[model samples]
Target chain A: MLTKRIIPCLDIKDGRTVKGTNFVSLKDAGDPVELARLYSEQGADELVFLDITATHDRRKTFAELVEKIAREISIPFTVGGGISTVEDVQVLLKAGADKVSVNTAAVKEPELIRTLAEKFGSQCIVLAIDANLVNSEWKVFTTGGRHATDINLFDWAKQGEALGAGEILFTAMTRDGTKDGFDLEANKRLSESLRIPIIASGGAGNMNHFTEVFQQANVDAALAASVFHYGAIGIQELKKELQRQKINVRI
Target chain B: MSNRKINIAIIDYGAGNVKSVQFALERIGFSGVLTDDITTIEQADKVIFPGVGEARSAMQALKDKGLDTEIPNLKQDVLGICLGMQLMCDYSEEGGTEGMGIFPGKAKKFPVPLKIPHVGWNQISKLKTELFQQVNEASFGYFVHSFYVPLSEWTVAQTDYSFPFSAALAKDNFYGCQFHPEKSSLVGEQILRNFLAL
Candidate 1:
């Protein structure tokens, strides 16, 4: 049986982890590689590093950080944020990052998905969509969920799959940072609509939320940042609970 | 044990990233040279064929570099990962590709209603080869692929997604894994260590 994945997403700024991760074992909480190694050791199925750096040297620093993480951490990891061109993805993959996720750039140029998928197999290209419900419709948002687009969430996800996206990282902007729970309704609809695997992101408060996202929404994976970074829930404990509930988890 | 002298060659035909595999070897204290040269690969102590991409084009890339013919002829122990594993089979339904015929099976796409890529962590059970040395039964392995090689005598391990499929295949000097061992954490590192030990 394929286990439901638990992913810890870290926000990277200038190649270093921005948030103060609350892992007591960690020597330097600001080091992305240290946090990534800790998560991998804790049975994290995969990791995502979302680079929030805005400087021109973002590429060099992020690539170096990726190289360090790849050398140190054995678990698979994905890099995202400001990924717009083929060269950007090429550099990351070359640096040993297993996969790269594209959100805003993909929305701006839908062909970028096809190009990246064609160049670096669909398995390594994840299409991340930030969605918000407005007037009973899930509208797609870009530029870190700041700008709204008229694109329908389902339509865009379906198109992304057709364009050769291997997986969809659907993040509900409204549910994000709320820690209430995932947007089960929207995620369930999206998971059922797309042939690719759906990773439900945002609104993960506790172990129940992870279980609910898996059982109710039938998502392949659940991704959260704060709950994991702040030590609100431990990965091993969460997986054990999921296992007890008969939800298959890699323990 | 990995510090011992061994010529490791990771065949690079521009199909996909081999850096992860190289880095994984580094973690285990081994360095692999990335080369498409037949002589270099043929002379290596162990060969790692890693790839990710469309089957037809990957096959084309292999042929362009003349690795398509040389890969099978190598007398050294060879291991293929992911698409490299798929391409070692007799055929693949993806792009209707005819494989290198090193292994006796065909790769087919998973049936509909199941997720396409079969991504994330899954367990590999019924281990039958030394490649899984010291690895527990039904241990999880990270996988990301749309197509899978059906179970056959060459199957060393099996994983269930839509159904039982070849997680690892072994025959003679060639071994293949559908999952990325370099990215599968400790279990994967052990698998690589076992392979290098061979």
Candidate 2:
């Protein structure tokens, strides 16, 4: 009877929140800590802060930001982007992050997932996969979805769960920023395929999209950026809409 | 010690988020110490068993330090969180392992169509003890696990998935929550406060 979570993802760059279309044309959103507080007040079940430039900068200010945000919000928060090593995971957790996500690093070094799971526990390690439809198959992409990996999305998700990843955050590159709806077929496939919780990210236009994802895909949570960032759908109103649709959600 | 000062000992067996758990306790105006030392753990007014790892390995770690035997003997009120709660049972399907036997039950995976790891917050109904005192019947608690304790005489609360599962259990000095009270919001904090008051 666990309630389906409504999560707001904040993409961070240079210590500020930003949103972009199709993972490009980034524009400043606001201060991460302030946005986090706002989301928490809006009844967001969890918050995902991804350092979009963590790999490029070769430095991690996300840890300090995580510390600041955790101090302000009581809800669970996950930090991702540019997390490659056990030390990186430790630094974030030590800075008060509830979970640390690894994407590009995990794709390159799969054993790093097992190592982090061992060191920080599975619940603390989240494996993020950016997937896109390539030649009628969901293919994994890396380096901020710029490079396409030959690995199949389903295969990678199973491997991630086997490696003790606590959860799988899957983003469909094709559906991302389109706002038409979630990649229902992809999410459904992954949700049915993986043993762990699957969080559907990328495309979320309105509350109906959330309902569609939760009801049809059976994803544990629905994550969106623009819809939540631009005040298109408030978390409370969205939860009400989901509740109206008979979806179990926290009021 | 004054009634205002509640000394809480968070058992450290090289598993779980001890810092976050400690932070939550301190946030609720309680003094908590994260320790593996037998003396300090035994001396605390209350003890919290927080764990997040494989059952067999964590049990082996506990047995290595002889804490496996010392834990069940403590007279103070004890609370087990997540894997710690699973370990308090008779056995676990995880690693085909035996548990601490504090509760007479076995932990197993939820049947298919209900998912394996019952992750996310779920509402708790059928409340039966002071541990849930003043908490709403529909109050939600954060959970992240694949296995759960079946209904038993020790069960104090129940939640439904593919079937009704034990959300909370209480027997004598031992209390177990499949959910993470530390990660849960106000209701979780109140549950901790109730435990501290006990």
Candidate 3:
């Protein structure tokens, strides 16, 4: 059987790896290529580069960084953030990203998913949903978690699948940067409700948290930033622990 | 002529993932060129067809570039990945697309009862080809597709998803894998190495 994937997402700003708390109060991590190569060697199944660069010229720099990282790493990797057009997906994929994730873009222009899927195939089109708990329901938040849309998380995920999205990357804002572990209940619901693979993102404090998401939530993959970015946990050690727990992780 | 070294050409049919495939080859210490040129493909020591697109349109692109006819008649080692593997089949139910017929089989979408596009890694058992040289039976490869080639004489490997399907196919010098070897990490690179050795 295929093992659950452990993905370490890197937020790139001005071509450098950065870490933000709840998507704020950013801190410098390291060089993107150096960090990416280290994680891949440390037994990461895949890597995600979130282009958090706020400027136009910096986005181009991020593309070059993706190419450099692609040359350095052999495993599959995804590039996300600020991807709002077919041409944007094209530039990144041509730069050597195995996959591209679209969040706000897909929400703003749902047809963009179809356009990308038609051109690049649905297998590579990942729909990233950033959501937060609103009242009693999980609501989708867009614009980098600054704006909560009227879209419901569960409903939007299903709609994304219907829109030819191959995968759903669901990030729960409440648990994000809280270090209280993943929003397991929400992740579990999403995983159970959707037939497509669900990649649980945010709120990973330790290796056991990873195992918990994989075991309890039945997530196909888990993405963490700070736990991996700050070197708080080594990917190889985490995979080893997952193996000891009998959870299949790509080691 | 500085041509003594082996050259691998990845057939580009306007579909994507060719760069990633070439990168994988380079990462494995083998340089691969992405070209739709007939001369480049025919002369290379090995040819790779990495496909990631819709069936009808992808086949149309292959046909537009004349690779549709060129690929089926290749005498050298030819390895097809994912949709590349399916395009070698007799036909595909996806938009009722016709394949190169190098392998005697048809590719079809999973039934509605099962989830479409059997994505993610799964086990490959019942291995038969030299492609499985050092690759174990329990080894997994990353797969992402809604359509799958049915089991046939060309099937050298089998994987269960919805039901038993052709995970890998081999016929004469033509070979195909229904998974993404370029994206499948170490196990995948190992499979590519086995193909190179063959």
Strongest candidate by TM-score: 1
User: What order do candidates take by DockQ, descending?
Assistant: 1, 3, 2
For model 2, how does the per-residue alpha-carbon lDDT over A60-84 read when each residue is reduced to its tens digit? 5666777777666667888998888
The candidate scoring highest on lDDT is 1
Give the TM-scores of the predictions, in the order they appear. Answer: 0.98, 0.91, 0.93
Candidate 1 deviant stretches above 4 angstroms: none
**Candidate 3 backbone collisions, by pair:** none
The number of clashing residue pairs in model 3 is: 0
Error at A72, model 1, angstroms = 1.0
Model 3, span A76-109: residue lDDT tens: 8889988998888888888888889999989999
lDDT of each: 0.92, 0.85, 0.86
- How good is model 1 by TM-score? 0.98
Candidate 1 residue lDDT tens string, A1-251? 99889999999999788888788888999998889888888889999999999999999999999999989998888899999999999999988888999999999999999999998999999999999999989999999999999999999999999998989999999999999999999999998888898999989998999999899999999999999999999999999999999999988
**Candidate 1 per-residue lDDT over residues B59-137, each given as its tens digit:** 9999888888889888989999999999999999999998999999899999988888889889999998789989999
- Give per-model CA RMSD: 1.1, 3.7, 3.4
